[model samples]
Target chain A: MNPFPASDYIVAAFFLFCIATTVGGAFVAILTARVIRSVCGLMICCVGLAGLYFFLNSPFLALMEILIYIGAVCVTIVFAVMLAEPDEPPSGQNHGPGVLWGVVALVVSAAICWGLSQLSLRGPWVAPAARVNDGSIKAIGVSLLTTYSMAFELISLVLLVAIVGALVIARTGRTKP
Target chain B: MSLPEPFRLLSFLVGVMAFVGFNAAYLVWVERKSAARFQRRPGPTEVGYAGLLQPIADGIKLLSKQLIVPPGADRILFMVAPLMVMIPAMISLVVLPFGGSLMARDINVGLLMMFAFGSINVMSIMLSGWSSRNKYAIISAARIVSQDVAYEIPMLLVVITLLMITGTMNLNEIVQQQEGWFWHWNLFRLNVNPLMPLTFLIFFTCMLAEINRAPFDMAEAESELVAGAFTEYAGMGFGVFFVAEYANIVVGCSFATVLFLGGWQSPFGLWSGVWWFLLKMYALVFTVIWVRWTFPRTQFYNLLNLSWQLLIPASLFTLILVAAMMKFL
Candidate 1:
């Protein structure tokens, strides 16, 4: 008898789809001509990342990935796009410098990607000796307050400073120097 | 439904979707009649009986309209945004605890999942408005981003306070905590603490803002922005947004019902089931419609001031107060 059912194949197919979506969305994000379309590409990539996170068994992180990236970050980028007229330069005029920059960028990205892939694939892949936490929301909350409390407080402080800095910068151009 | 199993979840999703569809249609009808009554004028009495079938007429009209793609608009994003909105609005309904056994997914982070998925609705609006290539739509989108950012803080604080009081994030667990008597509902936790009412009020207003209902509906102010982000959409492109808005309202009110009101729990310890859940949800929804017609649209600055100045401070205070109560009491 078949140990694995048709449902298992369906799930595997869905997982493959998620991988395709993530890679395709990222490719579109970098390759797109229109700045706004790039934002859409980023959003699609985020959604795919959510799927990946779901597969990783942290549905909380999956949802938060959608919430913070697509919801807050992309929307703010959209606002900036609206306020500041932006469009890709379309490989304007230069043949030599442009190609040079393109090669440099490509080389950098490829190296990083290859390095990370190797690091992941070459892992020992052994289970941890002991479990510190269950990775539930409760576990996350407890660790955030207990073990990671300092970092959590620092993050909040950073966000507060960023808001203040934004306001200060926004207010500067209006007042007479 | 337990969701380690996929086959059962697939069937349950199908049923839940049908229920959501019926809820959206019925809500549109209710909203129309409620608005007519508030205005002291007759509603669509010609369609079926007492305007019972007006939503069908509206649906037919929307469906029949031409789907025109404006030349300047981003073709793909314009097409995709409506579906984007419809997806998350429906997904959020999955985790909402309707009754003892009426939920689809009872994950521990139920309320957080709702909030997380709900944010995508705002993102979709941003995309649609940005893609439309209209100044009004762009402006509306910008306004919405700011409004969402401001209102979300107070709402999160309210949710956090509730999480502390109830000592759980699961919607089913939260609802179970409020069982037996109506007074046991978290809204009137006045016996243990005085901050619950304020938190509830904060939650209600934030819920209205989150779903883009009036008087907080300045982003879609019809007269000012010519229907705002929806100015360029036509036919079912617009229809999808309309359906999604009503669906979001239902989801928001359902959330409020579960969080504050005694969800599916009886007032007098009598009949209980999904019916009581439906009753509480609809009653909250009716109040949403009632408030929409009664209040005038708020000014944009005034709206920000209300959220940032009033609601934010009040909610933070409530959060602190509740924490203290939990510590000492």
Candidate 2:
């Protein structure tokens, strides 16, 4: 039984807030003309998605979402924007190929949306008979080190290669004195 | 009799809020007095005895002053940035175990959660700088991001070293493992990790950089960047930034206390309680303030080099050394 009767209402309100934040942030990301604002919008969307993950009983994933996306990815984007031009180029006119391209883009997005909603709504949503683990940090750690050990090592190897490649590229641009 | 669940949660939240508010106010006084002492001068002896009422007066002054947005600044982001900096640090206080059974929430991943919220701190600084529309602030923002990114690696490496030795991410559990004598503490657990003290040093160094304290305070290097990221903020906006900085110091020091110095555990094996926790935490804070007053602000390139070049390899070495010791010894 629930101790606080109003807790359900509170949870529902928070859920609604998360949904609103996600949708609102995505809109800002897409509709904003400034690149910096768009990056901020993306950060907000990631935060909202983290909240949604928390609601789905995955606090680990939620924390990782915030840690990786909002912390690392968004900050990197902001850093890049700071170093580069931060504003979008102005659209010249409402007429011409822009209007046609916009219409076609809208149609494509609508179709994708329709297809996704249909697929999700009609898909089987049965609960699994048994969970392999309780999804605690310990469980995740065990599985990571044991079952997914090879995959984990591969990912780390790939990341190391990427880092070295990045260093090489960055080094090439600077002339030796 | 125990309080109801909601009531218990509410009381804990309120208690943590009060504790944060008190620390934020008084820590400024502590720093001022300590800095004064280091310089051989009387600090604030004005408002009340030893300037006890100074923070209150300062708070009132900051609150009464006007919050101004520069002509070209982004209004919403500028207004939201200070609150953003303050809130996550406050949230982190909820999970910090003050004494036995004194934590607000005992989540399994409490350490990770604190760090997750802690990571959000850099974003707020970046936003404040970028939104201010000031060149100095923007430069400060850029420096903060790179500084955080560089130090976070060694910080995480050192943490992983401790985690491997302790076998848990829960702050309370980590403390529990270090129960009994001072030698049982992670800092002195040489039987497990021979480089335990060095590991703590790496973590402390990273923490100093992480919280933007002196020597690593490139985010607000006043001589260089004109008050750094919060240059355009006025009154309570600046006041909140000041409060958040102190609050973050408390959080970071508390984290170090928990991870290394043994949270709430008495060193002499006598009465163990919140007092010991506070004693250790404040000692770390004092060290931090002392460090600020003593060392000159480091060069930005040196700051990065310290992290990427020296600290990272050293921490990685400690991690492997600890692992091998655990495996064979």
Q: Indicate the DockQ of the complex predicted as candidate 2.
A: 0.57
Give each prediction's DockQ, rounded to 2 decimals.
0.47, 0.57
Q: Evaluated with lDDT, which candidate comes out highest?
A: 2
Worst 10 residues of 1 chain B by lDDT: B1-10
- Residue B71, candidate 1: how far off, in angstroms? 0.8
Q: Write candidate 2's Cα lDDT for B33-147 as tens digits.
A: 9999999999999999999999999999999999999988988889989999999999899889999899988887788888899999999999999999999999999999999
Candidate 2 runs further than 4 Å off? A86-97, A128-136, A149-161, A175-177
> Which clashing pairs does model 2 show?
none
lDDT of 1: 0.85
Error of 1 at A174 (Å): 4.7
